[model samples]
Target: MHEDAARAFYAAVDEGAYDQLEELLTPEFVHDRPDQTLRGREAFISFMRDERPLTETRHDIEAVYVGESELAVRGTLRDADDERLLKFVDVHEGEARISAITTYTTQVASRLTEQ
Candidate 1:
């Protein structure tokens, strides 16, 4: 069930159905991005709307593991000009509503300015 929920979440994002995502997200849903963390469903929705304006977004899931109310999805994100490997951990409620999401990017960050 967790795996299915994870897949459905990604599918919704790929289809650009931001509204549908709300159904799968918990009220306290938290998304951890590379730069910051977004808390709450409203904040998450706003974040997606602002970030995902791409021509396309695709995810190729290599594996999915479910444990209790948690799901781990290992996949690759493919777009028109870039491809990124991503690993996502989703904590779900009884009804598959994602309560939290932690994502990791394969890209390495370089320091632009020395502190």
Candidate 2:
């Protein structure tokens, strides 16, 4: 269930469906970015809307560590420009909700020939 929720969250974000984000995030959800931390669902939605416009987002789950009431997904995000490794920890009550996300980006050069 936690894995499903995490996948759904990524899918919604990739699709630019900010409305669906609320369903998967906690009201007190906190997002820690390189520069700042965003609190609440509204703030998160706005942050994603204004900052990250992912042309392509993919997640490859390497492992899942389950705690008493939480699940941590270790994975990577691949786009056309770069790949980012991420560890997403979700806290669950009944349905899964993203509590925190830590990510690191890797540089990847384009392979296309210049026109």
C-alpha TM-score for every candidate: 0.76, 0.65
Error of 2 at 58 (Å): 2.5
Give the alpha-carbon lDDT of every model.
0.68, 0.61
Per-residue error for 104 in candidate 1, Å, reads 1.9
Off by over 4 Å in 1: 53-55, 81-95, 108-115
Clashing pairs in 1: none
What lDDT tens digits, residue by residue, belong to model 1 across residues 55-84?
Answer: 265777788877776767777776655555
Across residues 17-111, which tens digit of lDDT does each residue of candidate 2 receive? 88897888878777664445677778888877776545466656676666665566666666655555344333333346776554433422232
Instruction: Score candidate 2 by TM-score against the native.
Output: 0.65
